[model samples]
Target: LAKTTQPISMDSYEGQEVNITCSHNNIATNDYITWYQQFPSQGPRFIIQGYKTKVTNEVASLFIPADRKSSTLSLPRVSLSDTAVYYCLVGEVGDMRFGAGTRLTVKP
Candidate 1:
């Protein structure tokens, strides 16, 4: 199993873009990769997910390098409402492991 590493926290202002990155070493070839966003006292919500190249949605974009050892979650034009803890997950369906997560504080 791979272990992931991420920053403890990050700060950004409203209307700014934020990028949170996670690094997973010794990742398996079949491991599923994804990102989640969690607000205080709330369960994590799916944000963006992918295992190769890049995947984009209305809310955010997920970028993975060719080696698949790391990924970055990019949030465009974030607002105060986007303040939350973002986690990077890797593994099989029922065995996914989440990183410590990056706490994003979107200030006004």
Candidate 2:
């Protein structure tokens, strides 16, 4: 499994776009980049996943460079309700693990 690095906390105002980057220096070819978002007292929910290039959905977009050493999660026009902890994970099926996530605070 590849270790992940992300900010301990981040602050944003309502209606602002936010981008969180995670680094995985030892990422392997079989490893995929996955992100999850968790609200207070709730389980984390999958946000996005990617092997390389970009992947997008209704909630967010994931960007992975060719080297696959790092990735970014992009949220558009976040609201106060969007405040949550974001986790970045890198691994293959049986080796997946979650790291200390980035806390995002969205203010009104």
Structural similarity to truth (TM-score) of each candidate: 0.94, 0.95
lDDT of 1 by residue, 30-71 (tens): 886788999999999998779799999999999999999999
> How many backbone overlaps does candidate 1 show?
0
lDDT of each: 0.89, 0.91
- Cα lDDT of model 2 by residue, 29-99, tens digit: 78888899999999999999999999999999998988888899999999999999999998875776777
Worst 10 residues of 2 by lDDT: 91-100
For each of the candidates, give the backbone clash count: 0, 0
Worst 10 residues of 1 by lDDT: 91-100
Q: List the residue pairs that clash in candidate 2.
A: none
